[model samples]
Target: MKRLVRLATLAACLFATGTVALAQPAAAAPKTLRYSFPIAETGFDPVPISDLYSLTVVAGIFEAPLEFAFLARPVRMRPNTAAAMPEVSADFRTFTFRIKPGIYFAADPAFKGKRRELVAADYVYSVKRHYDPRGKAGRLYRLESAKILGLSELRARALKERKPFDYDAPVEGLRTLDRYTFQVKLAEPSPRFLYVFADGSLTGAVAREVVEFYGDRIGEHPVGTGPFKLGAWKRSSSIVLERNPGYREVLYDEEAPAGDERLQAVVREFKGRRLPLVDRVQISIIEEPQPRWLSFLNEEQDVAENVPAEFANVAFPNNELAPNLAKRGILMLRYPRSDVAYSYFAMENPVVGGYEPHKVALRRAIALAVDVEREIRLVRGGQAVPAQSIVGPESWGFDAAYKSEMGDYDPARAKALLDMHGYVDRDGDGWREQPDGSPLLLEYSTQPDQQSRKLTELWKKNMDAIGIRIVFKAAKWPEQLKASRAGKLMMWGVGWSAEQPDGDTFLAVGYGPNKGQSNHARFDMQAFNALYEKQAALPDGPERQAAMDAAKKLMIAYMPYKVHVHRIWTDLAQPWVSGYSRNIFVREFWKYVDIDREALARRGS
Candidate 1:
């Protein structure tokens, strides 16, 4: 009877232990968002890096004072790290900003085990970095041209004195009003200056201590008070980011288009969750077209940001979601991309570059001969619209109905122009020679990608019909970009997207001062320069648009660059992805994205 009593006691203890174990909660599953970039990022450093892919990563890791609303259809601006929208003077020359208190940068070794707070001084230092002679800023011209009070003078003094920039000196135009407030005094009225504040890469605050500690390696160690922190980086191969534990709480703010059923559904799905629902993000650099698309098909990546044009037909046969993929619960979103793809002729190259009438005729003839429509239909898989203007359709001065010779493809006119300019077959070789009677072989720059190969094939056929022999120069994108900036490339095709919806951004490409920067073609015309400055100071209206129109006509007349087509892009998201609408002006959307933990967990199991 005593042994039975002991056995009963043991059983009671076991039962109590089992009950406690059952009451405990299970570990929460991690939410991860995986995606790919078609091009390799240079680095995260904002001032020198100009590539779109690098800036996209930088946007997520850095915080600007203002940001575009995630779901707003017209791309509305809202306060990000700032306490509120900046106050501007009636003339628009003076602007003041108030930073929010209590924001802290993500913990880093540079802080020496102490928390670093983001303050107005950090912004002051960040702006000074661009003016510093040592930084070699790629976008310095934009700020200098804005006529920021005393800022350009500071940069000029640094160059003249052959010394480092003086960051401590008080500049009349840019000064802090207090601990939390800063003011910018422009020399002239700059109505669109506020747009500069919205881009994180240009205006993102960086702590001086962090910059000093990392020095030249600051690009590798980006310290910011943003939603995500760089957890690991494999240079060009892969990049991974984890949610910032110290990130200030961002509540759900659904500002979608009214009565839009699709967006309303997404708003309801992410209605209650704190932003950055995804705990981690994994990014891979897959430059090839096929593998990038296939990874999405295999479900290895959660989103395909821009589906490859080569496989667009396969993904959406007849531009509709395929039946086989619909069963697996995939979503496809297609939109007209606000960008321009064009080919520029280096104005310094002896063969293709000259201001002479014949030189101009040769370029125009080539532009007219190349069939943009055929290229779009075949190479781009009918995913692009013929670009009528260098200024994108979304810009303030763009006119959709106003057509120009930029988009024309008349082979007969091209042949006639070539004949008038002394570009004719010599010695029955059936290939046109230069006006100087030298060989007229055009060295067109190209990449090794499948799409590039197809485009090159089309160009060969088009040029062959015009009696102009052409050869291709193949190089990696980075190398070609560096060469293009140095005026080493004869001709190269590239795309430029607007950071802000302004016509000036595209018009600035022809401005003489921007040569080797935005103006890769080096087309320096005094008349265009005068118009560019005149329009920049004018308000967005008929007067400013008229100036822009005159500028675009000059660009087309010279034919330094041939604007090809504005692209239409298709992006795919898996069933588990949520809140995936794209804002044209907003590049940072990772924080708004929510990964379904349960669905992702199911797939893993």
Candidate 2:
């Protein structure tokens, strides 16, 4: 009887333990968002890297003083780390900013167990890093005309001494009045300077300790105070970014203009919610279009940012979501890109790059021969529009009614111009020769890809029609870019996306000082340079517009760059992805994106 009583006691104890175990809560599963990049990101450092892919990744890991409103239609600037908008002087040369307190950088070894709170001095240091000649920042020319007081002298001194840049050196243009207040003084009136800051160029604050710790490997070691931190990177294959656990609590809020139904719905869904809804992000680099498209269709990726032109018909019929994809609850968002794709004639090259009348006529003839409409229809699957000028449609100085001869397609006019310039088939070879009887064969650099091949064939046909001989040189995109920068390639095709909504952003590429950097053409026109400077000093009004128009006309007349087409991109998102919107001016939309884990699991995505 005693043994039976003990057994009953043990059984009762087991039942109680079981009950307690069932009452406890379960741990939540992690939420992750998967995506892909058509090209591998170059690196994390923002100073030397100018590619859009790298900038997009950098945006997540860095916080700028100012940022674009997340959901604004017209796209307005707002304070991100700043307490308020900058205080600008009447002359628009001096601007002061106050940063918000309590913001801390992500914990790193460089911090050495000390809290790294962001202060005004951090911004000053970050800007100075770009001026370091050793860094060789790609976008340094953007600030060349700004002429920050004492900055040029500092750079000169550093070059003369051949020593490390003195970060502690005081520059009058960049001053920290206090712990939170920072002032920027420009030599000339620069109304668009704030826009440059609002973009990622000058906004990201780099702690001096972090830079010192990383040294030469700073590109690989990116440390910033943003929503996400770098998790893992496999050179050219994949990248992962995890949520910053120490990130400050910030809710999603924006003052969007009313009467937009789509934006209203987005606001209702995410207005008060905490940002960075997704816990993790996975990026796969799939260079080939077929594999990338297959991965997206197989539900491995949540978003496909750019639909390949070859699959445009299959993805979007009549520019709307295909019936099949729509049936699967997939969403398609279309936006006209604020970008331009063009070919640059290396003005430094002996054969093609010259300001002589015949050379100019030859370039004009080649530009007039190529039919942009046919190229768009056949090669791009109706995904682009003929670009009128260097400035795209969304920018301020883009004139819709402005017409030019450079963009026109006239084979007869092309042949006539070539013949008038003494270019003729002298050796009965059916190809034109220079007036001096030298073989006039143009070498064009292009990537070895299906799209590039198609474009090359079209170019060959156009050149043949005009009795001009051309040879195609295949090289990787980066290789081609390097060759163009070194002034080795005669001509090459490239594209530029606007970092800000200003015409100057596009015009700066042709500016003389930007040569060997942004200006691949190496075009140095005295008149165009003067107009560029004049426009930079004026505000976005009639005077500035006139100056910009004159510059555009000059660019077209010289034919240094044959501006081709502006793309219309169709972006796709899986059903499980929400709050996904396309912003041309901003690429860092991961924080605003959310993943429906339950729905993803239900669809087996």
Candidate 3:
């Protein structure tokens, strides 16, 4: 009777206090998107880094002043960290931007217990870092060419005087007007300079204290006011990023481009919701193709960003998804990328480089000898179109109807040109000799990958047909990039992607001033350079088109580079994943993607 009375009293007390327990559901699992990089990333620092893979990682960790709307098809630019678009002067030489208030960087030891709000001064400091003589890399060509008032002078003084960059010095071109406003002035007109602000990889904001704290290891420690923060990283191996707790409230709002059902569906589903649907983004460097493709098939990877060409028939046969993959609810998105793959001759090389007629004929003949169509069919798995010019598709001034001899593959013509230029098989060795009767040999820098081996085989066959000896030097990508930048390479094959809507980026490769930078070939032609500048200054019209057309002709006429083809990339995603569109210009893509955890569990993914 005492026990029953005590239990009844306890129950009554629990009921009175509303403390009775009920069954609760388990907490949902953290949403994560796992993907892979075809190549290894160099570092997270935006200034020195030039590779696309590293820039992709940088875009996720930094905030730009402006950004392109994710769903806007005509590719509309919108203010990101800025409260609104910049106020531009009529002459296009001056621009002003207003930084949004209350945006804070990810908490770091550098903060010293105080939240660091993003101010206009932060941007000024960030831009100055690109010109600082202490450790700045040479991405300052575009800005230098723009003649950003006193900026070039400041950099020049630092370099000439052998002193540290004057960060405290006031420069008229780049200055903060107030706490939230910043203005930029150019000595010359630049109507398209605003596009540079939208590229976070080039113009992202970086705090000074953070730079000071990390010192030489700044690339490893990225502190930004972006949506995601670096959680863990193993250089050239794997990288992990987690949701930023202190990121400002940024909703996913966009106007879907007309006639695109996929974008419209994504916007309809995620409109007005907070951005960055995933909790974590996990990436791995898978240099080879087989393991990466198998990882996606096994569900270890939620997204296969680039389907390997070797497995194209297995992944998508006859330009359609394989039945096995389709049954597993996988989706394939195929599109032509705004990029070009080409092989270039080192213009300063002793054997192949010169403006002389015989040397020019040697390069033009070699360009004609390469079977670009065969490379596309065999190595690229019929996933590309022959490049007719340096300009990529979808960029301004790219005319679809335009044609040039850049893509022609005529071995007969190549032999004729070579024979006409005194490249004869002398000394009975069955190999051509230089104009001076010296042995004519070519050294091509190559990677040790399977794709490179195949490409090398084709190169050997082509050169053998023309009775010219060729050799290859193998090295890792980073090592090759360093050597290439220093003009140590005799010849190399690589790809370049457009950074903006305009085609100016393609021309940078042949620009004389871009030598030791984008001009890996060290190609310097006054006629080509003049045409490039003229086109850049003119608006998109017949005048600009004519200038660009002349520029392409010069590129082909000189044969500094053998433009191969424009690639077509295909990305595969599981059904549980949503909003996996391949953006042409933007690098940070994980923000707009959502994973259906419930469906993931149900489907056993």
Among these predictions, the greatest lDDT belongs to: 3
lDDT of 1 at 295: 90
Which residue pairs does candidate 1 place in steric collision?
none
Would you give me the overall lDDT of model 1? Answer: 0.86
* Model with the higher lDDT, candidate 1 or 3: 3
lDDT of each: 0.86, 0.86, 0.87
lDDT of 1 by residue, 281-394 (tens): 899999888998889888899999878888877888788988877777788888877789999998888988989999999999999988999988888988889987788867
Q: What number of backbone clashes does candidate 1 have, counting pairs of residues 3 or more apart or in separate chains?
A: 0
Off by over 4 Å in 1: 1-26, 601-605
TM-score, one value per model: 0.96, 0.96, 0.96
Among all windows of 10 consecutive residues in model 2, the one with the lowest summed lDDT is 254-263
- lDDT per residue as tens, model 2, 1-605: 99999999999999999999999888866678888987667788877777777888888888889988877868889988999999999999999999999999989999999889999998888888878989877677776668788887898899999998888888999999999999999888998888867765445888989988998898888888888889999976998999988888899885545886666787788888887888999999887778888899999899988788878999997898999999899989888888899999999888888999999998999999988998898888889989878988788898878788857999999899889999888999899999899999999999877788889999999998888889999976666666677789999987798888888988987899888778989999999999999999998899999999999999899899999998888889999898788678888888888898677878953
Q: Model 1 compared with the native: what TM-score?
A: 0.96
Residue pairs whose backbone atoms clash in candidate 3:
none
